[model samples]
Target: MQGEDDLRGLAKIMGFMRAVSIILVIMHLYWFCYGFFAQRQWTLELINKILQNFNKTAGLFSHSLYSKLFAVLLLGLSCLGTKGVKNEKISWKKILIISSIGTVLFFFNSFLLKFPASGATSFYILSTGAGYILLMQAGVWISRLLTTNLMTDVFNNENESFQQETRLLYNEYSVNLPTKFYYHGNWHKGWINVVNPFRATIVLGTPGSGKSYAVVNNYIRQHIEKGFSMYIYDFKFDDLSTIAYNHLLKHSHSYRVKPKFYVINFDDPRRSHRCNPLNPEFMTDISDAYEAAYTIMLNLNRSWIQKQGDFFVESPIILLAAII
Candidate 1:
């Protein structure tokens, strides 16, 4: 991880390098096209002028050549190398090798044009050298940035609360379920690992603090919209049950499927369905029986503060587990 400043700095440097590479590529391409199609007579005139001024006759100046075409191809390769370096798709050493070869070829072309001794040629040579130097500098800085470690800057371990909050973001989830979590006054989408078979959500808040409302408004609405099956436990109040029932009704009307809703209230003797923890249907297998016995013992004790239970308390659980 890197700090925002470091990341932004690296990006800006890469941008500058990319710009330089593109400019070099375009300049070479323009020169190549001009030399190939339009600049034959001008090249002849320039060569004649150079020969006359230098007081020398050279066979090399007798004909127009496609030297700029080679420059164009080399510069194009350099541009691609710079782009790859910026994207981290090419190794720095490889880019350096490619750019160095391009630079050598560029300098060779410049050398071929240097004997003409014109103001335009001098400026072109200076600018090309400066551009290539900047490109190399950018590459070096980018490599440094990639190699440097900024883990401490990005993660402030001294801030325990911040670490705790960020830890939830990296949790492995079976499904990335979106939760329109309300944080810092605005509603933003977050994700939870509740879809995992071993994972579940536990929302806790004091009474009248919108705990039920948050679940009903955000999560319940999402489940209904996505046509997902949901099981809600509303212990004290029927808030969640009512919200689920309404959503189910709306969904049924829209999809034309009459979904069933089961309610089991242990507090209401008249309306509550009979639920037996010791039913034979629950103990058909050893795993089921073990689970049933554990659940029964948990419900009876309600707390595990004392791990080593006294004989009076442990004897019944052991007896019930053995019998099951």
Candidate 2:
């Protein structure tokens, strides 16, 4: 029991670390987006400039080297943090020692490279700037790598926990249900095998056989603590509104509940009003709201078909029929 509790505690810590690492990675990725997509050549040029500036002996012996070295150390620290190392064990003493050595080397190199034609100060400044940039890159890389590792670890841990929880639940309810619940297939059937809290055991039943309640009570409620987001589509407003309200109330500020109901009747003015506000309305020059809704529906349908992985030469005909 103690072992299980310890595992659970470690799992929780790992989960939190994973979330933080992911957030940091996302922020770093956002910052690097321009370099990745738009200004890649400029970024490479800047890196090259830094390398050239550091090649000079005087440029090498500056505060810039210490800064670069410290930056690298910071990246290592981030990795250690992700790995669940305590803050006290981070070894600031070692980092300071290395930084001091780097600082001395930088100044010595600067003195050696102070020739008649060389602009030692300018070179030092450029090298230092380059080193700072490299440090940022190192931090980003460390965050990204740690995020990946943490996610993988947490996923594995959660999967095992889920299996254990499911078994316990099954034992409690096995007498009630005909089929015994067991782990099977990818929890989330996407490109990656993500363990979906919602997509658990599929109900083998016809309509109005309590399938909906079974899904809601058994799966959704069970994983409520895991910070799962869900959207339930129901034609009836009352059911959907109730579910949405309950979700909003239960989750409070931490979770979001968005209920989207398809209003097929475009002829009714109220129906038009009920449509997604951001939806395009090409029919009226004043507002493209209806058109936007239509586009969303079309995209949803297309996505469904794509998920099915069925392609045909006559797909255009089927799509036209759907539009009609």
**Best candidate (score: TM-score):** 1
RMSD of each: 16.6, 20.5
Q: What tens digits encode model 1's per-residue C-alpha lDDT throughout 1-324?
A: 134456457656656655655554444433433343244344455744654443334332222233333434443443333322123234557656655664654444454443544544545555555545544554554543454333432342222211112223422323334455433334555555445534556778889898766554566765665556677778754777787888788776544455677778877767656677678877787777766776788677876436536776667677778898
* Model 2 bad stretches (over 4 Å): 1-166, 169-201, 217-225, 256-324
Model 2 per-residue lDDT at 300: 59
**Candidate 2 global CA lDDT score:** 0.42
lDDT of 2 by residue, 1-324 (tens): 455687577666655654554443333222323233233352455644554464454343244334334444544454443433212222435445544554444333445234433355345444443443444333444444444444344444432422223222232212122233223323421111224323455557887787756554434443333344555444554465466556556655454553332334444566433544443342454224434444555565675534443454235434544444
The number of clashing residue pairs in each candidate reads 0, 13
Tell how far residue 164 is off in model 1, in angstroms.
Answer: 20
State how far residue 120 of model 2 sits from its true place (Å): 99
Q: Model-by-model lDDT, in order?
A: 0.52, 0.42
